[model samples]
Target chain A: DAGITQSPRHKVTETGTPVTLRCHQTENHRYMYWYRQDPGHGLRLIHYSYGVKDTDKGEVSDGYSVSRSKTEDFLLTLESATSSQTSVYFCAIMGGAGLAGGNAYEQYFGPGTRLTVT
Target chain B: TQLLEQSPQFLSIQEGENLTVYCNSSSVFSSLQWYRQEPGEGPVLLVTVVTGGEVKKLKRLTFQFGDARKDSSLHITAAQPGDTGLYLCAGAPPGSARQLTFGSGTQLTVLP
Candidate 1:
């Protein structure tokens, strides 16, 4: 492992409960992202952080929020977990801004965290 | 929206067979990448195609980027059970952040 880990590899919770997932990396990468993988929809970005205290929304950020307090840790919080949020969540990191011609900008993903909302 | 579309959502073939997976989009990309994901795991990068019309091979796997940079294909020769997984294609548009727009993906099963 190049140094990316997600907490609570698996989880089960009731709907309407608040939940948080954590992503940690030791590579000191500048970019970190959170994505959800669902059947037929593949992986959809939920949020991403470029640096500590800097974050932005992704295509699917309606019910989700992210916080990056340090360069090595990014947290994704679901204020109210729902059945629809029951999907595998992945954390990824890249060394650079991923500009074109930056062949090494490929992201390295962590082992996914499976969440079940009942 | 710039979306990547992958075809043949599912494929099943016998060992030693040859097959191809495709990723297409109307929007041109600055670069494209292919990944393979197994159950309960995150996708692992297989290859990245940057130049239009470029081709790269990794062992028995062949990757091709369309001349227009709007599509790409992955061809596997002599498929094996080890190749069973979900194949995904992702693209990074020019001038945009390195956020990848991924295709739905292709689930491939190779029977031994």
Candidate 2:
């Protein structure tokens, strides 16, 4: 409900091809995250942004890059699509903790994008 | 790295039955959140527990944070088909509130 949207809801591409996924948020939240969900692995963070022009790598950041030039948009890029990269990618936005007075900060998510690499 | 383990990787139960899913971690968490995700959709936050030993109820769903803040549980009463989805638990280690580590998740199937 944080008004998050991911572009190209589904995509199919061949190996060695480049791909980019976009995550746009309408809430202007300060923190944005990119995660890939796979069976057994659950969801692993790919990248995250703390603010505009501020981005950091996550546990499974290999072969991925991200940029956040605007407050409402964060982009995740796969330098070369691989079979290992096939998974559902989710974008989430955090509005900060205690906005509602709780110690935990809730993250709003987008519908997600399913990518297939052949 | 903070790791959360969700038990009962898969559960199948008839509608109106009760069920509970557990999320456990040896590391103390500053806060924990539960999320439900349906097919082809991202996870939606069901509830968040921050204080140790806090319990919150949402309709027929009950969520409890362990007194040590190292574990949590989610229970559903009279489950319905609408409750069929993947339940994931995410936790933030003490001091860090946004960088989350998510559990493997429990896939619940509530049969009609």
Candidate 3:
């Protein structure tokens, strides 16, 4: 509902193949993030972007790469897919009211992309 | 890595029943948030608690932050079928606004 969308809502790829998922937002928020959701792991941050071309790795950034060349789009790429990477991927933008005079803790997430690597 | 542990990985209750979900951690958090996610969709923000011993209510749902800022709880009164979903709690550590530590989540199924 925050004007966010993820491409390739569902996909099934074979192992060792390259794959990419895209997150697009119209809110123009300064922060964007990539997350993977699994049954027992909850939601894990994979990567995040603070500004155009400025990005940082998150807790589970291994086996993944991201690029944010523009404010509206952030891409997550898996160089070689693996069964361990099969999970629901979500893209989020951080905005709204927050504490410490910084961006709030609220995150607006996209519908999510379901990637299945066999 | 700071981890938020949630209890009752899975729950099932009949409609109109009362239920509570817990989120706990050993590290202190500057703020905590709750989100509900339904099938095939992303999680949606429910409420945010920033102060210790703070209580906030959203309709039949009540949220309380622990007195020590290390835990929080969600109490649902007369739960409905629509309340069935995955509930997640995320905490923002002190001086950090760029990221949050999330709980593994509690999946609730309110049967009719």
What are the TM-scores, per candidate, against the unseen true structure? 0.96, 0.97, 0.97
lDDT of candidate 3?
A: 0.93
lDDT of 2 by residue, A1-118 (tens): 6788999999999999999999999887999999999997778999999999999999899999999999999999999999999999999998776543556788889999999999
TM-score of predicted chain B versus true chain B for each candidate: 0.98, 0.98, 0.98
Clashing pairs in 2: none
lDDT of 2 by residue, B1-112 (tens): 8889999999999999999999999999988999999998999989889889999999999999999999999999999999999999999887778888999999999999
Error of 3 at B63 (Å): 0.3
Across B32-95, the per-residue lDDT of candidate 1 in tens digits comes to 9899999878999888889899999999999999999999999999999999999999998887
Per-residue lDDT tens digits of candidate 1, residues A6-105? 9989999999999999999998888999999999998899999999999999999999999999999999999999999999999999756334356436
Determine the backbone clash count of candidate 3: 1
DockQ, candidate 2, comes to 0.75
Each candidate: what lDDT?
0.92, 0.93, 0.93
Ranking by TM-score: 2, 3, 1
Q: Each prediction's DockQ?
A: 0.63, 0.75, 0.62
Give the CAPRI class of candidate 1.
medium
Model 3 off-target regions past 4 Å?
A99-103
